[model samples]
Target: MEKIKTLNFAGYFRNFAPILLLFFITSTGFAFQDDRDFNEYSGEILNNKNGKAISSAYLSLNNSNISTVSNTDGEFSLKVPKDLMDATVTVSVLGFQSKTLPLDFFKVEGTEVRLIENVEELSEVTLYKATNARLLVQDMLAKKDENYLSDESIMTSFYRETIKKGWTNVSLSEAVVKIAKSPYNSSKKDLVSLYKARKSTDYDKLDTIALKLKGGPFNTLFLDMMKYTEYVLRDEMLDSYNFSFDQPTKINDRYMYVVDFKEIDESDPWYYGKLFIDAETSTLVKADYSLNVDDKKKAEMMFVKKKPSGSKVYPTELNYQVDYAQNGDKWHYAYGRAQMEYVVNWKKKIFNSKYKIDSEMVVTNWEKYAGDNWRSENTLIRPNIVMVDDVSGFNDADFWGSSNIIEPEKSIQNAIDKIKRKLD
Candidate 1:
């Protein structure tokens, strides 16, 4: 028999391994796990004072590499091994006190834990009279090496892309990926590989004329303005944007300077957004921006990869957000999200189709050492694959084995369950 070649969701290509489908079920503030292994626990993180949901809190077992983060609804699931049953798990967030609990604290249906807020006195504001906005941006760029990661590292990340037609979600694609993060001073691009991936089965509902997203992870990484300075913030481009100082905010107990940037020249397509700089360190900690798609024809050229001939498409919105978190003395890329909406007009223009596309990535775990460079053939890149059209079905409940991933929303879980019943 001729040999068959197949690649598993874990990024390994082996001969004769069973080809199985991976599916993620997201529901309303609920996490589902296999009862066969009761070690896997589910719970919610909340505020101790007001009992509000504490989104984006980090949780992990002490002395162990296994971990996961709470979703926007303050829910998470962590699988504990028999040996680690006695270990305490810690929950922490940027502006909250850390809370620890025993593994036995969680029940099958799940339990809730609250963390106290960490309030501190604000630092005295120092008004500088130098170049102002220009000088602040310059310092942010100059201190890249001193503030960001100095060495290459391996990061395990969760990636998700959703396509919506009007208000109904037609397609959802998600993956657990391993990324090779290059050093701040290096010119090499960050590398990503699929560790585990799955696609929603309701993809058939999508418009027959496909709405595709290109360069998955690569597209988001490029939005790291600090790393790709020339793309948006070159010295020459500085003149095109009107920069002003905004209110100072707090992040991780440290004060941050908010810089507002808007394109003064509307003659050309430009970007407008806010940059949050660490007040003491002058590092670009977070950026929330969007491309101005004023020129309909020009914006169409930026997003339309391939479409049916008679279909006329107009770009409506293009937005991007990237955030970094401090780890010890250095800060690393923590999470990134991009959202865009476009309207497609048919030949007559009377009937039009509107599409919303979104992508989110979160770095769950990282190590300073990856040993060796990832093989060229194993890299995930553009033009070769489109993540949404590639994945299908579910084979097991343990979709992500030992790796950390963002918990799915409750709506997604309920959708998965309903779909599974129909398929069966």
Candidate 2:
């Protein structure tokens, strides 16, 4: 549970050496807002005790279905309908006391919310004689139908992927997607169709080589471990990794079982991470994992699609995180993030090129829909296609209409303003 928020995009450039600015740089899109009937409120959630950012805090309208999670930087944006202006909003994070206030609280006070840590009474734990983490995971999968989403549903998600060359934001691609999530019992994959997309890239910043993400949103969705149990928790695969239980914790007032895992078999490449399971139902609450790239050559083959033959490419880090939130009886996918860093070395170059790729998807809205409505045609994107190249330019302010989106940071907002002026 002590994972670091590594990829803070706003301050990414400041951490490294100065970037070589290109005169003809490409800009981004605006922080979309609807002026007619909705008021968009932006805010940051922080720990009241230390003032540190509380990443991934969930905020929801007290009586409405509208909600959004705070990003890695503890920032979140929500558009309140004119009628709901007087409604109360509740913010909750694990191990912290929930905070409730009127929507006007943010409107007047302007956006910094501090939540106090919850003081829990510790009780003595009685350990069972047979404590098998693998068996518990198997039980989790066995009860998936009861604890997880078993029926097909449509999820409105906001997806974004950004590429950074050294300290420069070389490319950024974003899309609002409609996901046809399949039932947990089926082997069918979730389908993603692009609803609206926008992108901007500076080829010169990336050293003339386009840094395209493979599978894009599809990759992020698979990070939902419960949906793709075969990727890690299969019966046969259980023997390949070592699992042990750690200290128990609380999430949303319920206890959780922390199971830490590591690869024991070195014959094949694998991932090592921890799984947070709901103690009451054995449901997968959250997963934070990273691939073990001990074998660089094999790992490179798995990640790279195409590059200059003379150049050497390898991945240094591949980290992933996924969170699921409860609605009523079943839990559904909430948020996912993947961050990877790679290095490229040319035959006789003075400096090796370093690039970081970050992709994240958040479920903004969801509802029950017919499974047969899944898009199966040409909606699927290929691995070779650069997502930015296929998307439309970020030239429209009303790009999303009334749909909700993860609020962009100040840096992104400034870039969008500059881009809109250039277009004008």
Candidate 3:
């Protein structure tokens, strides 16, 4: 967790529209434009048995790096060059049967995709001999080099961050970025360059204060614990937590050893979470974790960077989820999401307000680094750059023209409509 910068919009009413520009030296959009350069496939992923939405499922192209994650409603829209229409697409999730079809199978009007629960895969799974979850986790960490990406590459990712007052959104920011990704075997950090960005914020509705997540997409990127071990778990940091076996499970078609972990060391901030490891390869497939908000002070330290002297903020929720997708024999970051909620207790206010902030990103495309070394210092985004401050309004047609992004959930869609109305 980098930092969650909290700023007070005390004078929001003083100006109808005030643009906030936040820059930290150390730190760090919707509507379909008809894109001629690429073809768009739209679909809703549903559970075959019950017809339920499956959120965060991975939808990707075959034999290519293009990919996108399903939204909260199990809806997705993926874009690829017109020439790739003959390529295949696969939709997969944690406990569902993966489905693959020709790219042309999806209608321009959108397609309905249903995945069966992987019950067959789990039918005789429990019959296997039990193994130690802790050891499985250790082994997953030990084999990271062989199981994950091995070459330096450049990745194109779609990133978004939003803040809501309970269910109503106060801000929405999105960007298409190019990341100079370091090899998983190396300790080097990834560098990001902004390609295109757009934002819409309803500051007037925020009442008196605004909560902003610092580092934007970097918050979720750091949750790639397999690559950046210090953020969560590492070989040497394993001793700080307690690990135990949960019920074994299956992801896609592969067997997985599920393990739950909890912080036991009082010397550090507490956390509890689960790790899904590939049974055969001992590779980590997914990680779901959160800060133990039992300690108010510790949770605050992890999120709150600054706030007004007159207000007290208490974090109610802080959690993260990161998933990996396979390319050949090695896996790389596919999708990541971070969510947080907190209550603001103003000194003189009679009622406290609770606000939730959510950020998610998925790597849509990537390839080995080549051609011009585009690492010019001025062309990159700082780790703590506040994206909402840097971009304004949903006025860019070019942004929607080429990016493959998660479909906005219904609530967020409605929020955007209302904000657009007000701005109009």
Best by TM-score: 3
Q: In model 3, what is the error at residue 194, expressed in angstroms?
A: 0.9
Q: Which candidate, 2 or 3, would have the higher lDDT against the true structure? A: 3
- Candidate 1 on 1-424: residue-level lDDT in tens? 2222221111110111222232222221212234444366777898999988887676767765456677778988776666667899877665676778887787754689888876643434553332488788877888888899989887777877776788777667777777778887777777777666777635455544555565555556666677667667866778778888876666554667788999897765678899888877898888888878778886665555455667667667778887786666788787777777878787866778887777777776777855563644354543124564433354456666655567776766666666557656
Error of model 3, residue 195, in angstroms: 0.8
List candidate 2 segments past 4 Å from native: 1-35, 62-65, 83-88, 118-130, 370-385, 390-393, 410-424
TM-score of 1: 0.78
- Residue-level lDDT of model 3, residues 145-229, one tens digit each, is 9999999888888898888887788889887777888999998998887777777766666766656666766767877879988
Error of 2 at 413 (Å): 4.1
Off by over 4 Å in 1: 1-41, 45-69, 78-131, 201-203, 349-351, 376-380, 388-393
Consecutive 10-residue window with the lowest summed lDDT within model 3: 9-18
Q: Top lDDT: which candidate number?
A: 3
Off by over 4 Å in 3: 1-21, 24-34, 121-123, 126-130, 266-268, 390-393
RMSD of each: 8.7, 8.2, 6.3
